[model samples]
Target: MDTAMQDRALGAVLAGACGDALGAPYEFGPPLVAEQPVEMRGGGPFGWEPGEWTDDTSMAIPVLEAVANGARWNETRTHGRLLAAWSDWAQDAPDVGAQTRAVLGRLTANTEDAARAAALAVHEQQGRSAGNGSLMRTAPLALGFLGDGGKRPLAVAARRVSDLTHHEDDAGDACVLWTVAIRHAVRRGKLDVRRGVPLLPRERRTLWLDRIAEAEHSAPADHTERNGWVVAALQAAVSAISTGDGLVDTLERAVRGGGDTDTVAAITGGLAGALAGASALPEQWTVLVHGWPGKRLDWLRSLAVRAVDRTPGPLGMPVRRS
Candidate 1:
């Protein structure tokens, strides 16, 4: 792989984690007006430590790990691995969305079918399963499926993975759009949320196109009230990435968008990182951002690199900081 593309791949996950940690302290708070300083101080409602990532990046770790290890999305074993990893993470996760907790809690079997059934049951019982939980963790799927032929597989897998915890069509649609867009950004080094609209069911294309246009025409905070929903969450992330002047500003716009700040920023960071590359992320945030599985900057970068290049290395073995 070309070095620049590889750097963008690394940026996809690392910056995503950075965004998650950066926004953790501001989650659920009221929207911040422009010029309000945003920092990674990390002591929000969850009482997270400075630069600590939340469930957004935590849930993504297993997906990255599985894909890096050569797990295909179509395999029941792959789904089982993802479910088991998530079950383990949720056991002590400082903050997991109620929708995700419900689905994972209902998993009596570790198979893909069983997970889907559990998710479907939750959706039926709750009457809504379109939370942003799935979208927040979707960046890794894009990284895993990069290259010329990665789009179709990525789309299929993104929906299936999202369906594991979010059974609603809207949730699945959001994942497909975001992951595909991330893949495109990683390959082309540009932002284009609408690039994935063609992957959606024909009837939903125009609706999503209108939504993307709305996001482009407005600011991230405009979606805050409903940012918990998958569609609005994607909108907020897109707005931040499309409107902000740079990587830091893009993530800050997402955090400022409010309500589910970590998730929106995490989602934004993935695409923004792909477009800007790992070198574009502020070193201050990268140095501080660490999370579940006892990982830090190097490990996150390894996950992204290994997922795309499929090169063998000590995945997360610590080494001296560069």
Candidate 2:
């Protein structure tokens, strides 16, 4: 990989961990004004120690690990390992979304078509199953696709990964767009939040454009950007990226935006960090934040770099020519 993309990949992972840990202490609480620059304090509703990341990064790490280990599109080995990791994590993860909890529960108990069966059950139980569950951990999918994939591979990998725990069209669609945004930021040095619109199905495109409009132009009174809803989370994270002046401030804005704060901030951080590169992050923040799966920032950085270098996905190519 070129020096620029490599740095951006490193930036994505570190800043994501940083944002996840920074927002951990204030997950569902009212947004707090920073009396000072944000710190990675623990003890949110989950109550882990300082610098510990939450379910957002915990779930994401499995994907990153599998990708770094060379898991590609529709590859059962990676998916199975990810499922096993989810089952193990359920035993002790500090927090899990309702959709993810349901899906993982079924995956643990049954071996046949676990992802589809679990999602089908959830759909039957609840008329709709759209949540931010799958979207939060999808960044690595993009990194894996960066080698020889384009819009089609990205869309396919995104929906398939999301179906493991979330089945709603909106959730799957959000994952595709967000992953594309991350890739765009890494390669091009900026986010095109609407890049997914042209790639979306016709019906979803119209709905999404309307949704994006509401989210993009939302005033605080509108409350378009808050909570576990996939649309709100996507909108909030993208809006924060578009508006903030730098990586740190962008993350700070996402956390202070309130409602599902950690997820939103982590998502935003991944995008902004990719565009800004690791140098954009505060050194102290990277030094403090880490994965609960026992990965420090440097470990996460290496995993991210590997994901970009290997893991060609369905296309079978390297990230760059040697």
Candidate 3:
């Protein structure tokens, strides 16, 4: 990838984390009024430190790690590794989505089959599993699959990965669509959530296209009440990205929608970051963003690049301890 494309790829990961941290304090809070001030204030129900990311970004780290290890995303071994990593992380995660917590907590074995079965059981038990948890962690998967022509592999891999913890077809479809959109934005520097609609199952394309259109024409608030659902969450993220002028403003717009503020903003951040590039992220937010696995801003930067480069060598990104 060229420097510009690389920068956008880096942005997708870094800005997603930054957005997670920036919106952390506002999660489940009332929607902000238009032009209301926003900052990385932290101290939400989970008591996150200022600039500390939540599970949205924390869950993405395993995807990045799998890509950096050169693991093919569709393989069982790859799924096993991701499941094991997530299981370990959830053991102490301050806040995990109810759907994710249920699925991950039920795992008695860390294998891919076990994870999938657990996910399926949970979905059957509840009769609904279309949660935003899968989509939030899906951005990094796109970077790993950018090399595949036609992006077919990218779509398949996205659904497979989503299925590990989210059995709902809507959740899997959302991942495929958003991941494809992120891949396109990084490659072309444009925001088009609809760019991935054609990649959806033939029966589902028009439905997603209409959803994308609805998001474009609506405000983020339209989806905030149900943003925990994968489709509504995707809509809120897309609405913010399509309506706002830039990455920061888009994230702010997402936060203003309230409810699952951090998840919505993190979702918006991945696409906005892909379009605007890492340099477009605010220095203030980037400097303070930190999260699970002892990751700081520098680790996320390196992980983003390494996932794209698929380089297993020494860290290419400079280490900046915050």
Candidate 4:
């Protein structure tokens, strides 16, 4: 790939991570509260201090690791690796979302019905709690499956990975749709959410509508609360993208829109990063988020280079060596 494409891909990854970290400190705060400038929280609720990532980036780490190791879709080892990543995060005990914490707790207890219990618990407590958790970490999937020449396969792979815990069809579908959008934006160089939403594939379009309507009708009016609403997360992401603003602007918009702010901002930022690249991110924000484990900007750059190398070039040709 040319230097420009390489830069764009790297920018996308870094921008996504930066957005995740920046939004961490204000995850479930009031929309009005988030509108106020954030104070440096050192590493946040975690010991790492300011700019550290939350569950959003942690879950994504496995996706990138799996792809980097050349794992294919539906591979048992791939799924194991994904689960292992979650296990590792559990050991670290980061500031996890309530639904995720409960799920991981069951997985750690080694209950015979752990997976089923986790899925059911989230669905019952959070009402199909897809919650943008999977969406936030979906950028690597976009990178991995780019140039595969079909969106369905990639979408299916996204669903499989996310369904491990999210399970809800709506959640899985949102993950796939967001991944597709990010990949398309990265490859095509821009995205206009209002224009692009209508053009999504039929399945994705239907899912998008269902999710948005759910959010509009059911999302709590309060801006500072966290209800684990997946639909609200999707709406906020779409809103941020439609604004055509810089990373900080988009993230602030999403975060302030309330209901799962961090997750929503993280997901929106990933898509925006793919659409706009690192330059779209403010330097101070990037520096703040550059060093968290599995969330470093430089590491993301390396992963982006590797992912691009895997893409097939023109005329079904192999990717050309730089």
**Per-residue lDDT for 45-146 in model 4, tens only?**
454457776677777777877666667765656776677677677776556666666676667433324554676776887666666566667777766665
Q: State model 3's lDDT.
A: 0.86
| Residue-wise C-alpha lDDT for candidate 3, range 1-322, written one tens digit per residue | 6788888889999989998998899998888998798899889989999999999999999998887777866568888889888988999888888999999888889887888889999999999999999999989887776653636778888899899899988999999899889888877787677777777889998988888888888898888789989999899988898889888899999999999999999999998999999999878888899989777999889877778777322223321111
TM-score of each: 0.95, 0.92, 0.94, 0.80
Candidate number with the higher TM-score (2 or 4): 2
lDDT string, candidate 1, 1-322, tens digits: 6778788878888889999998999999999989799999979999998999999999999989887887777777888989999998899887889999999999998778888899999999999999999998988887666654677778989998998889888999999998988888877787788888888999999999998899888788898899999989888988898788989989999999889999999999889998999999877888898988788877878766677666221232221111
Cα RMSD (Å) per model?
4.6, 2.5, 4.6, 4.6
Clashing pairs in 3: none
Estimate every model's Cα lDDT from 0 to 1: 0.85, 0.77, 0.86, 0.63
Q: Clashes in each model (backbone N, CA, C under 3 Å)?
A: 0, 0, 0, 7
lDDT of 3 at 210: 86
Model 4's TM-score against the true structure: 0.80
After superposing candidate 1, which stretches have Cα over 4 Å from the reference?
311-322
Instruction: Tell how far residue 81 is off in model 3, in angstroms.
Output: 0.5
- lDDT tens per residue, model 2, 1-322: 7788778877777777778888888787766565645567778788867877888888888888877877766665566677788888888876888788877776634342677788888877888888888888888777777665565788777888888778788888998888888777776676677887777888789888887777677522134334588888888887777678888888888887777878888887778888899888887787877766777887888888787777544577656532
Q: How far off is model 2, as Cα RMSD?
A: 2.5
lDDT of 2: 0.77
